[model samples]
Target: MQATRMISGRAIPWGAKNIDTDIIIPAKWLKTVSRDGLGRGAFESVRAVPGNIFDVPANQGAPILLAGDNFGCGSSREHAAWAMLDMGLQAVIAPSFSDIFSGNAFKNGVLAVTLDEVHIARLMAVAADGAIITIDLENQVVTSDRQDRFAFAIDPFRKMCLMQGLDEIALTLAADDAISVHEARQAEDAPWLVPAQG
Candidate 1:
């Protein structure tokens, strides 16, 4: 996972509430195990409509999405986060998020910012104006070119992992030396517990 200390770009003004995982990436797209190409399926249903916000010309390649309350509320599918990243969304701002989706997003290096409805409205307006918005994870704040600033809270551990680009596998590998030492100690303490040489 790439570290996400800062994200600066136009945001997609999608304030639709109660958007579930199936809506983010339909279940039909879940047949494959690979994360690649999921972007084509991201918001498949929404894009089917004429003149959807996501399909608007100005919203192309936006790195941030401004969503309404309770974003990412549905089945515990990590694909939702993957699809968003593949679609070039580095962060999502909303009034709230489903706990499972938030965890999955964090694991995949996607910044999910939670703010009050007032802040959401302000950001949504800024996004609709095609203004640049910035997410500074280092400072735990979101800012817009319109001089709007909103502070958000995140778990310290999750913040550290994202800033360091440390996924669970990276975190486990970082403790390799300690794990080796423990294994050696166990071998010395109980010979029978150690696997016999082939």
Candidate 2:
């Protein structure tokens, strides 16, 4: 996972509510075991429509997504996070989000920001005008070039993990010294429990 402290870029202002996992990447695209190429299938149904927001050239590769309430709802598919990452989205700002989806996004190194409806509407307006939005994870605030600023709350542990770029594997590895010490003590206390070497 990449460390991220600040994310600043134009945002895709797709304020449609209740966007589920199926709408994000679709089940048919889940056939692949790898995360790569999933972006091509992301929001396929919506993109099918002419002049959809996701298909807009200006919004292409935008690092931020401004969405409506109840975003990322429905089935818990980790693929949704992968698809977003592949699509070059690093953060999603919404009034609310599905608990499962939010967890998945965090584990995948994507920032899921929750703000009040008023702030969301402001962000949508700015995004519609193709203005840049900045998310400062360290400061827990989102700002726009037009002087709109809103503070958000995040779990401290999640914030720490993201700032340090520590995924589950990396977190476990961080305790390697303690684990080694415990194993050594166990070996000394119970030699019979130790596996025999070939």
Candidate 1, 37-102: lDDT as tens digits: 899999998999999988889998999998877899989989999999999998999889999999
State the C-alpha lDDT per candidate. 0.91, 0.91
lDDT of 2 by residue, 15-69 (tens): 8899998999899988898878788888889989999998789998899998888
Against the true structure, what is each candidate's TM-score? 0.86, 0.85
Each model's backbone clash number: 0, 0
Candidate 2 TM-score, C-alpha based: 0.85
Q: Candidate 1: where is the Cα deviation over 4 Å?
A: 170-198
Kindly give the stretch of ten consecutive residues in candidate 1 with the minimal lDDT sum. 164-173
